[model samples]
Structure formats: C-alpha cells, structure tokens
Target: MSTGTIITGLRHRFRQLNEKPLRDDLIFYFAIIAVASVLFMALPLLTGEAAETDGMHRAWFIVAGTLIVLVQGLITGAVALLAVSLVEHFFLLFVDVHREFEKTMKSAVYALAPLILFSRAVLLGVSFAGLLLLAWFCLSTYFGVWIFHEKSKDRAVFVALATDAILAFYLHRWTVGPWLAL
Candidate 1:
C-alpha cells in the first residue's frame, strides 16, 4: 500500500514480461507491421490520390510517402510493446507467481484477436479518419492498460505510439507494389 511497494511490484511485472520469448514475439509482430505499412503507403499512390502526380509532383509525393511509412514503423513498434505490458497485467490476476509473466503474454496475444478484427472494421468503415483514431486512442490507452495495471501509465502511451508507426509503414508499402511472395 505504500508507493514504494507498488513501484517495486510494477517493476517486477515489467521484467517478467520482457523475457526472451516475449521479446522475440514483440519483435516479430513489429516486423509484420513494417511490411504491412509499406502496403498501406502504396494505397493512395496507386489510386492517384497522392498529393503529387506529375514528375516533379511525384517526387514530392514519394518523399511524403516515405515519411509516412517511417512514422508507421514507429507506431507499430509501440503497439507491440504496449501489448506486452497489457498482457503482463492481465495475466497477473489469473495465475500463480511463477506463471504470471507467461500467462500475461499469452493473454495479450489472445487480446489481439479482437483488436485486429475491430481495427479492420474501423478501417473498412471509415479509413484512417480522426473519429476512429479517437476511439482507438481511448480504448487502447484507458481501458486496455490502465484498468489492468495500475502502473501502466507510461507503458500504454509509449507502446501505442511506437506500434502505430510500425503498422503505418506496413500498410503503406503493401498499398504501393507487387507483394513479395514469400
């Protein structure tokens, strides 16, 4: 009940979540987002909705598009990190001490099932409009992390921004060209 005890508990939980497998998973998810972001960048370009169309114009669009992709990479990275933090807190309630971190990670993966579907729904219905963003920010920040981990204040924000950037990049490239068959 002391502030120091709470901080210690939070730190322990954070370390547990950042173990080897969990970190690997986090990295993998960010890579997926990075690829997806490139696709997203190509969308407006292929459709000819990009700000510039002519030779000089195209050059401008390319520069702007690249910037967007980079931002996307940062955002998705943040999402992966946020997911890990949320997983940690949610798992804490269901398991014993030793299992807490792993359970949290698994639970976070499960949580993404709904978030992905929901985000798709939002995108299909409205694209990347402000309203959908407002909704995502509200949900991912307040209900997602804060409710579960009382100490999740900083984690939710930093992770969300990073993941959003990564996802944006993934989407940008996929929109632009032929998919690399893997």
Candidate 2:
C-alpha cells in the first residue's frame, strides 16, 4: 500500500477505536512494527562515525549490522505487543470495561502509527520534534485505551499515564538497556 493509504487508514482507525469489531489487521500492524524497528535499528549506520576499515571488513560489518537490526526489530515489536496486552489486562482489574484482549491489543498497536511514522525524525536527532512526537505518542496511547474502556475522562487520563509509564519502563529495560550496552 501507498504511504498516503497507510496514513489515511491509521487516521480512520484512530477515530474509530471505540467502535465494535476493532480490526486486528495483523499484516498492517506487523508491517508498521517491522518498518519502525528496521529504521530505528539502522539509525546507527545513518548517524554513526565512519570507520576506516577495508572492503571485506566493511561488507562483513554491513551484513552483521543488518542481521542485528532485523532480529532486534522483531523482538522489539513482539515485546511491544505483549506489553500492551499486559497493560490492558492490568487496567481491566480496577475498571468495569468489557473489551476483548485481542481487540484492545490491536487498538494499542494501531494507535502507535503516528509515533512509528515520526520515529524517523527522532532517529535523525531532531530534538524538538522528537519531544513533540513523544508527547503525541503518550496521548494517542491514552486515547486508544480510553476507547476500549469507555471510562471517565479522569480515569482515562490515569489509564493513559499508567500505561505509558509501564510501557516506557518495560521498553527501557528490554530494548534500550541492551542497545545502550553496545
């Protein structure tokens, strides 16, 4: 699909997060995750200092780097899916919402469309844009959860904050920590 089509689809999905039969669309969801993961993983190559190595060494390095990016991307995507599922489950405890786990997870993943698209700016070191994108991500994530729960405005805000915090902590521990070690 075209970029415009994807963006339009995401916007439509965002608006209808509260409606019935939330589309799982695993193919699209996984595609977004894959693209974001690959792009994020390749940021180092795009912005890192150039090495003074020979041809073979460079080739090997590129191959190794590509493999690493692919593997990490898949892992990060899977972790994110699981994280959303867990967060939704935890939130359901206090709230009286009646939503299916799979639908909730789909909402959570689809809501990340903007952040995934904006991630390129963050990876490119646009600090101000990155910060705005971060805020947008948090807000979108909150809305996603709110749609599923149909809770009060205050409760929805709380759920969003709690979900973002939990997701940030989990991702930092699993994804960022290891990346920083490299």
Candidate 3:
C-alpha cells in the first residue's frame, strides 16, 4: 500500500475507533509495522551517512546495518506487542472494556504508527523536532488508551503515563549508566 493510503487509514481508524468495530486483520497491522521499521532502519543512511561513505566499505556497512536493524526491529516490535498485550490483559481484569485482547493490541499498534514515523525523522537528527514529536507521542499514547477504555478514561491515561515513566527510567538506567560512570 502507498504511504498516503496507510496514513489515511490510520487517521480514519483513530477517528472512527469509537464508532467502528476494531479491525481484525493482523497482516495489515504487520505491514504497517514492517514499513515503519524499514523507514527507521534507513533514517541514518538517508540523512547524510550514505553520502559521507564511499566504495566497498560503505556498501558492506549498509548491508550489515540494514540486516541488523531489520532483525532487531522485528524482535523489538514483537516483544513490545507482547508486553502491551499482557499489560492490557492485566488492566482488563479490574476494568471491563469493550474490546478484546487482540483488538486492543491492534489499536495500540495502529496508534504507534505516527510515533514510529516521527521517530525516524528524529533519528535522522532533528533534536528540536524530536522533542516536539516526543510530546506528541506521549499525548497520542494517552489518548489512544483513553479511547480504548471508554468507561475508565482517567485510569487509562494514568496507566499509560505510569508505564511510560517506568520504561523511561529503565531505559535511562541501562543505556546511560555506563557512559556516566566514565
């Protein structure tokens, strides 16, 4: 599918989420994520690095990096989906929601599409834009969960923010701790 089509579909999905039934097409969701992953993987190359490098080394590096990114992105995406599913399931126990587990997963993935796209641009080196995008991402995530849990909108936002904070803490601890020690 074309980029325009995908963006339109995502916009429609988010806009009509309350009115329409949740989509059941796993393949479509997978395609969206895969395309996002490819874009993310290519960010470095497209921005400037590809122009900086020349000859065989550049070719080899691109090939290797692309493979690594593809594999890592898929793995990370799968793990994240699983985590979201589990978290949703846990949340469902206390608060009854309209959608099922799989449907929730689909919605969450759909919500992440914009985030994935914005992150690719950020990765390409726009710090200020990245900061703005990050704020947008957080708001979008809160709204996404809020929309899903119609009866418990406040709870949904709380859970989303809390989990995000926890994730950030862990990421910072692991990723920055070693560098700081030096």
Name the top TM-score candidate.
2
The digit string of per-residue lDDT tens for model 2 on 72-159 reads 8667677767777678667765666676677567657765666665667755555355446546656766666655555676776776
Clashes of 2: 0
lDDT of 3 at 9: 69
Residue pairs of candidate 3 with colliding backbone atoms? none
Q: Put down candidate 1 lDDT per residue, 46-84, tens digits, no spaces.
A: 787777568877887787777788686658656764655
lDDT of 3 by residue, 1-182 (tens): 99788756655566676455545444555566677777766766877745566899889888887778777877777777677556644655555665667656754565455555565555444445544544554555555666655546676666566645544464453333444666
How do all the candidates rank in terms of lDDT, highest first? Answer: 2, 3, 1
Give the range of the ten consecutive residues with the poorest summed lDDT in model 1: 173-182
Give the better candidate number (1 or 2) by TM-score. Answer: 2
What are the RMSDs of all candidates, in order? Answer: 14.7, 6.9, 7.0
lDDT of the candidates, in the order given: 0.49, 0.64, 0.59
